[model samples]
Target: MQALRKYGDPEYWNKRYSTASGTFDWYFEYHPFIAQILDGFNSKEISILDVGCGNSKFSEILVSKGYKKITCIDYSKAFFEHLFQEFHERLPSVHYMYMDARMLSFPEASFDVVFDKGLLDSALTGELSYVNAKQIIKSCLRVLKPFGKYIIISHSDMETRKEHFLDPSFDCELRCESIVVTDNDCHEGEERLPDLTFYAYIFSKHLH
Candidate 1:
C-alpha cells in the first residue's frame, strides 16, 4: 500500500504516460457532450483550462472546433512528447504547461471554463485523498472567473463527489446528471466490462 502512494506523485504519471499503450483518454473524451458542456458559452471566446490533462485528446478536439485559447496543464512533461508526436504543429496553438492542479499558478479569475475529466476521482484514490482532492477543486474555483463553469466527468457518484462542490467554503452552485458510459476501453478482465454509469457535474461559480 505504501508503493501506491506514488500514484499521487508526478513522476509516477510521467513514467506511465511515457510508456502507456496508445493515446489514452481517462473516462473518455468530450466529443459526445461538447454542446452540453459548452452550453451558453462561446467556445471561441472563452479561455479554457483543462486541469490535470493527462493524455486526453479533449483539448485537441476543442481546438479543432475553433476554440482558441485552450490551455492544458498536467504535472508531467513526459506526456508532451506524445502530444507533439500525435498532433504535430497544431498542438502549439494550444498552450501546454507542467503545473500542479492542487496549487495552480494562474491568477484569480483567469479562466472562463475548466474541465476535470477523471482528475478528482484519481486524486481521491491517492495519498491524503481528501486534502489533495479538495485543494484541486478549490484551486479551480480560485482561478475561474465569476460565473465561470467547472465541468467534471467523474466515476464517483454524486453522493461522494457533491460535498466538495457544495461545501459552504466554496461560493458555487452545482447541478449533476448521470450518464451511462461504456467501459469497453478498460482491459481489466477477459469477461466484458459492465456499462459504467457516472455523473457529469457542472458547477457555476456565483458572481461575487
Candidate 2:
C-alpha cells in the first residue's frame, strides 16, 4: 500500500492501459457481477453509468441486453479513445465521457443504476486513496436516485471499506454475492501468484 501511495495516480493507471504493458487486456468485458445486476433490473429505460468504464465493451453488452440509456466515464483519454473508436460505429447509442470518477459533474438523483468494476480498487492504492474513495462515493450518491442500486466489484480490502463510506442517513447493505478464486501456476511454463478473490457489493438506496 505504501509503495502504491508513492506513485499510483491517474497517470499510473493511464500508463498501465496506454501501452498494453500492464495486465489489462482490451478483450476483457463485463464481469459476472455486472451480468447479475443487469439480470435483476426489470426497467427498460433505466439511466445507467459505468464508472471507470474501460474499453466500453461492458457498455456494448448492456446495449445488446436492450438497455437504451447508458454512459461510460473514464480518466484515461487514450483508453477512452481506443474504446470510442472501436465501438462508436457499432454501438452509437452509448455515450462516452472523459472524466475522473472522484469528481463527477452530474445532477443529484440523475442515474437509476451506477456500477463500478475496478475503478475504486485502482484508486484505493494511491496517496489520495481515502480521499478518492470518499469523493467517488459522495459523487455517486449524489447522482444515484432514491431506490437505485449501486454495484461495486472490488478487492476484499476495498469491500471492507464500504461501510465507512456509506452515509448515516442511508440504510446500506453489503453482501458477497460471489467469489472468484484464480488458480496459481496453471500454466506449466512459469510460476504464478496466489489466488485472488473479488467481492461484489450491492448497495441499495432507501427511499422514504
Candidate 3:
C-alpha cells in the first residue's frame, strides 16, 4: 500500500496512457493468453469486466463471439473517448466507464469473470506498484461471484507471489495458467518494440 502512496496514482496512469511515446500506445489487439483462458470456460451467460481496458479490440472479438454482458473501464478519459468513437456503435453490447481500477464502485460478487490486460502491470510500473496491484485485485475479487474467475496479464513474475498475500483476503487460488512470449512482428520497425513476455494468472474463487 505504501508503494501506491509513493507512486501509483490516477495522474501517473493517465499520463502514461496519454503519451503516444509509450509502449502501451502500441499494444496489440486481442491478448492471446486472455483468449486461451476464456476458452477454458464453458459458461454462455458470462458477465465480464475488463479493467484498464484502453481501446480494447478484445471487446469487438467478444461481441462477435456472442458475449452479451461486457463492461470495460479505463482511468483516462481521452483514451476512453477514442475507444468509444471507434467502437461505440459498432459494439453496443460493450459498456465503457471511466474509473480507477483500484477504486471500483461495484457490488460484491457482481461479475462472473474479471479480466485484466496489463492493468496491474501499469499500476506496478510506478513506486507504489505493489499497493496499486493489491487495490485492483481486491476490487476485482469484490466484484467476482463465488467460483468466478479473475484473469490477469502481468509482465512481472511477482504476481504469483503477490497472489499468496491476497489468498487470506479472498480465499482464492491464483494459478499461473500460461505464459505467451510473442514476437508478433505485426508492427515491424514500429516506434514501439514489444519486449516483454506476458504471464496470465487465473484466480478462481474457492467455493466453501
Candidate 4:
C-alpha cells in the first residue's frame, strides 16, 4: 500500500519525468496498427483524451497526423508544465491539464475517445489498486460519448484486468486482443522466440 502511496503522489511523477534522460515510453512505443485504428476515425474531427499522459510522444504523433483536438491529462502539474514548454511549438492543438483520472472533472459524454496506456498498471500498485482502477474506468466511461471507445494498452493479462469489466456493475461492452510481436532480430528457429505479446483492452460505453 505504501508503494501505491508513493507512486500515486503527484510530486513523485513530476520528479520521475523531470529529467530528459529519464523520459521514455512505457512498455512498447505506439504501434503502427494503433495508428491505423486512429486513422479509421477520420473526418479529423474526433476529440481524444490521453489519460495519464506521462512523457510519451503519442500525442505528438496524433498532432502530426492532423488530430485537431487532443487533450493529455495527468495529476502532476509540473510534468505537464515541462511538457508544454518543451513542445509548445509542435503541440498548440494539444491541451495539457493536471487532473486525477479516478475523479475526472469533465462533463458527461465530453470525449469521443479516451485512451489509457499503463495508467491501470500504475494504479494497480497502490493499496486500493482495484478500487482505484474501477474509479478510473467509471470516470472515463462517464466522459465518453455514447458508443465512444476507451482503449487501454497494458502488459496485464486477461486474468488480471478482465474482472473489472466483468463485474456487471459497469454499463459497457468489452473486448480484449493480444498484441503479438515477432522479433526478426532472433533466428527463425530459435527455441526462445515465442510470441512477444501483450494485451490491449477496448471498452465501449453503451448509449443509455
Candidate 5:
C-alpha cells in the first residue's frame, strides 16, 4: 500500500500520464451506469466542472450525450496536453485546464455541477488526506451556484469516508447510492469475478 500512496502526488500523475496511450477513467467510464447516474438531474444545459478529470473520456462522452459547457481540470500538465489535443478541435465545447482541485481558480457560484470521479480517493491515499479532501470539497461547494450539484464517485463507504461532508457548514443535501459492477465474463447468468461496489455521493447545495 505504501507504494500506491504516491497517487496523491501531482508529480506521480504527471509521470503516469506522460506515457499514457488511451483514456483512463479511475473506475468505470460513462456507459450503462453514467447515464443512469446522471439521469436524476436531467439537464444538459447546465455548466459542469469535472475535477481531477485525468485522461478520462467521461467528459467527451458527456458531450456526445448532448451536454455542453463542460470544463475539465487536472493538476497534471501531461493530462491537459493529451486531453486538449484529443478534443480541442473535435469537441470544442469541452475545455481542459491545468488546475488543482483543492484551490479552484474560478469565482464562487461559477458552475451548476461539480463532479469528481476518483480524485478524493487518490488524495486519501497520501499524507494529510482528510485535509486535502476537505479543501477540495469546500472549493466544490464554494464554486457551485445555488442548488448546484456536487457529485463524487468513489470506492469509499459512507460510514467512514463520507461522514465528513455532513458538517452543516457544507450546506448540502447528502445522498449515497451504490452501483454494483459485475465482471464482464459473466455470461448468460454466470458469475465469475466478485462484484465491485462503488458509491456515488451526491451533494446538492441549498439555496440561500
Candidate 6:
C-alpha cells in the first residue's frame, strides 16, 4: 500500500506540485456541474466550505456567479501557500486556510454546504485509510448545517465509497449521481483512473 500511502503524504504532493507545469486539474471538467449542483441550494450567498481545495477553479467559478462566503482549505504547504497568495490578489473574499480535513477548525453547523472533490479518496491511501477517511467525513458532518449537503466527487465506485459515507451513524441521507467523463486527460493520481466515468456521492445532513 506504499503507492496508495504516497497520495496522502503532504511531502509527496509538495514535490509533485513543485515539478508540475501549467494548470493540471484532475477535475477540470467538473466545474460546470459542480456549480450547477451548488445552485440547487437556491441561493448564491450561502456559506460554503471547500475541503482539499486544490488548484481547481470551483470556488472561483462560484465567486464569479456571486457566491460570497466561500472558504477553502488544504493541508499541502505547496497548494495552501500558492493559492493563498493567488486568491488574495484575486478572490480576496474567499477564505483560504491551511487546515486538515480530518480535523476541521470550524464550529459545528457553520456552513451551509461542505464540498469535497477528492479529499476522502486521498485519505484512503494512508496506512489508516479507513480511519483517516472516517475522520474527514465526521468533521465534514459536524460543520454542516442541518440538511446541508456534503458533495464529494471521486473515481471510486459505490462499494468502496459507500462504506465510508453510508454509515447510519453519519446521520445523513445519501444519493449518488454518475458523471460521464468525456475528457481524455484523466488524472493519474486517482486509483480508478482506467474508467471513463466517475461518481458524485452526495450526503445530506439530517434536518434535525
How many clashing pairs per prediction, in order? 0, 0, 2, 1, 0, 0
Each model's TM-score, in the order given?
0.84, 0.78, 0.76, 0.85, 0.89, 0.86
* lDDT (C-alpha) at residue 130 in model 4: 80
Q: What overall lDDT goes with each candidate model? A: 0.79, 0.71, 0.71, 0.80, 0.83, 0.80
For candidate 4, write residues 76-169 as lDDT tens digits.
7667656656765667778988899999999999998999988887877766778998999999988999878888888878897777767677
Per-residue lDDT tens digits for candidate 5, residues 42-160, read: 78888889999887888878898888889998889877665467657777878888888999999999998888999988998888888898899998989999877898888878987
Please tell me which model should have the higher TM-score, number 3 or number 4. Answer: 4
Q: Candidate 5 regions off by >4 Å?
A: 31-37, 184-192
- The lDDT of model 1 is 0.79
Candidate 4: lDDT of 122? 82
Model 3 lDDT, full chain set: 0.71
Sort by TM-score, top down from the best = 5, 6, 4, 1, 2, 3
TM-score of 5: 0.89
RMSD of 2: 4.1
Clashing pairs in 4: 4-126
Worst 10 residues of 4 by lDDT: 20-29
Weakest lDDT window of 10 consecutive positions for candidate 6: 20-29
Give the least accurate 10-residue stretch of model 3, judged by summed lDDT.
Answer: 19-28
Clashes of 3: 2
Q: Give the TM-score of candidate 3.
A: 0.76
lDDT of 2 at 144: 88
Cα lDDT, model 2, residue 188:
82
- Model 5: number of clashes? 0
Which pairs clash (backbone N, Cα, C closer than 3 Å) in model 3? 3-128, 4-128
Q: C-alpha displacement of 37 in model 2, angstroms?
A: 2.5
